[model samples]
Target chain A: MREDFQDELTRVNRTLVTMAKAVREAMRQASSALLTSDHTMAQQVTARDAEIDVLYRVVEDRVYDLVARQQPVAGELRKVLTALQVAADLERMGDLSVHVARAALRRHPAPAVVPELADLFREMSTVADGLAAKIVSALADQDAVLAAQLDRDDDAMDHLHRELFSVMLSPRWPLGVEAAIDGALLGRYYERYADHAVNVGHFVVFLASGKDD
Target chain B: MREDFQDELTRVNRTLVTMAKAVREAMRQASSALLTSDHTMAQQVTARDAEIDVLYRVVEDRVYDLVARQQPVAGELRKVLTALQVAADLERMGDLSVHVARAALRRHPAPAVVPELADLFREMSTVADGLAAKIVSALADQDAVLAAQLDRDDDAMDHLHRELFSVMLSPRWPLGVEAAIDGALLGRYYERYADHAVNVGHFVVFLASGKDD
Candidate 1:
């Protein structure tokens, strides 16, 4: 209820949204690189991950400082602690984006997703971006509704991931072993990116409801 | 330090070890089931995962209560926060073991790993168990040395994972698409299981030396 607490909480919330945006951009660029075989874009996403780590550290320090100084118990404590968790989730979402980029980088000059499965991966990226935006809005507005919707979006991601698996497992699969590995792993990266976004959503719900679930 | 705080810290520490042991057992049994085609053991590992989740919640509640009630700062604060991080890592480690088990169960009546790759997965499981033991000991003794060694062990696990990849991508890969998916995913479960163990080690080092490396 303190004015100082309110100001600091707003700062944390702003930082979280900014961090989410950074990760969302990374995811988009990384997916673009994968779909288009843009080596330069992939490299950029991979290189930019260090900056995301710096943001993560900044959020962590702010959350810890809030707790150490204010010692806010009850709902205040939940809010402070959930900030740390949400920051971690966002940071990992950034890392998953980098992993997608790395997959592209690992097979440079050649796309990781085969022509047949490219559309599915493209859809996955779009869903991931949507979830990231929802998470940012959910955190900023403390909207548990938006946060919970991320799970449904994540379900869409999981379905795409499974579809990706079937492509690799199809009897008439044309891609070689290398493409199979790349596609499988690339699909997983996007799937995990969405999962982390959902995790942030759940953290927002926890912040709003004081429920760990 | 207050006596009651120390007592509660010890309780949390003990539950962490117990939880680690459960996950270790799960990892061992899951790997055994995969290597030996023991369906019952695979089922057991998957079934026991719920218990690990219960332990994770207990640790979370205790760590949060310690921070809220004790208002620990500085070193005490680091201890409480690191406890939370460590619990999350161990819980993920348990899930990874379940993943390994699920791999085996999905291929029921058939061994997931061919004779060629069984040895490598077995070695990975052994290495993971060794790392889990080191982590539990490090936490119990607060030994930075043991904690640091886990990263090195994790490197070994990664080496094995790369080796598994080479086998999957070999020119003469004997397995079909379905088997390849199972092998690749199972190998990853063990590799990632080790990675989470290393994460816990880093958390231990952070707790011991106040360095977040």
Candidate 2:
């Protein structure tokens, strides 16, 4: 019975890792859609979000079932609970991607705001991509150090976010009010996406620590 | 041993309920500061945020410990996980309040940013307060239907947010750049707070449904 429970728990973790990967891919594609004006890619990212949503439900169900049946000890329980939180964060990340995709669709062929936003978008993409990779590595290798670094990396994203805001506020920029709104919202979505990735990294740190303290 | 685990879980739930109440009060105080331009009240809200943060960390630790030790089954696990998510959301709500308080502090006597903004602030506070109240009650009563209604209430907040943006964009509003930026950020903070409240309501629904579907 113990071995069977362990197997089930591992399965759930694997599924969560897969969901995280899918969410990361969705974010990257959505960013590409925004940068390259690829509505097709944006559409793809939007459609894939439903898949992450489905996986979220699956993981939640399985983890709860495992907890009920196995009555896992403290360490295992933390793992399952952390997995649930991570799944929700990943799902939110997917939603962020969908938001980006919708924004792209609305601004197809790329708006003039792209010049002001391109650098921030690129830097955000790198940070998001790196954070996603680290999460996967942390889970696979159980490396808490890499997970810890994610928080620091988030600082860079935050700096870029402030810079983006300053640009929006600058009177020198000739972008009209509509373009400014789009840029601001777009910046916000990126910042939020990175924030969620940092949150996932925190979960990984908790899992690696193997104790609440 | 199983009975002891159940008792401990109940204790955790009780504590979470208390923390939620504290967070809701913090939000109310923060909004009051904004609406009434009460700088002292705003400072108090900011000071109290640290307490919310501490409570959040403590609850998180307890939840992690409980899960690892008790190995709760399906419903029990969902309850704990839901509590964890709600804790994060409540903490974020507190952060939003802090943001509002900071904005209040910046404006001092409160800059008149177009007549529409005052109305928008009033509408936002009402909706945000309602959403927070509903979430706390839904969690307390395990009421899914009420939670769903809270989700609908979020739409009104979103509409007000967009309308605020429209006001900023209109040439008629002479509150030029700085006020517009402040107004925009302020609106965003309120919208985000409402969004987090809706998230808590969703968790209440999940707990009630026993299925993530």
lDDT of 2 by residue, B145-182 (tens): 99899867899999999899888889887655666667
Output the lDDT of residue A62, model 1: 84
- Estimate the overall C-alpha local distance difference test score of candidate 2: 0.81
Cα lDDT tens digits for candidate 1, B99-156: 8888888887888888878888889889999998998899888888899999889889
What residue pairs clash in candidate 2, if any at all?
A67-B72, A68-B73, A68-B74, A71-B71, A72-B71, A73-B68, A74-B68, A74-B69
> Which number leads on TM-score?
1
List model 2 lDDT by residue over A100-170, tens digit each.
88988987876524686688778877887888788778766667888889888789889988888788778
Off-target runs (Cα >4 Å) in candidate 1 are none
True contacts kept of 1: 0.41
Give the residue spans of candidate 2 off by over 4 A: A1-6, A109-112, A211-213, B1-10, B61-71, B106-115, B205-213
Alpha-carbon error at B172 in model 1, in Å? Answer: 2.1
In candidate 2 the C-alpha lDDT for residue A143 amounts to 76
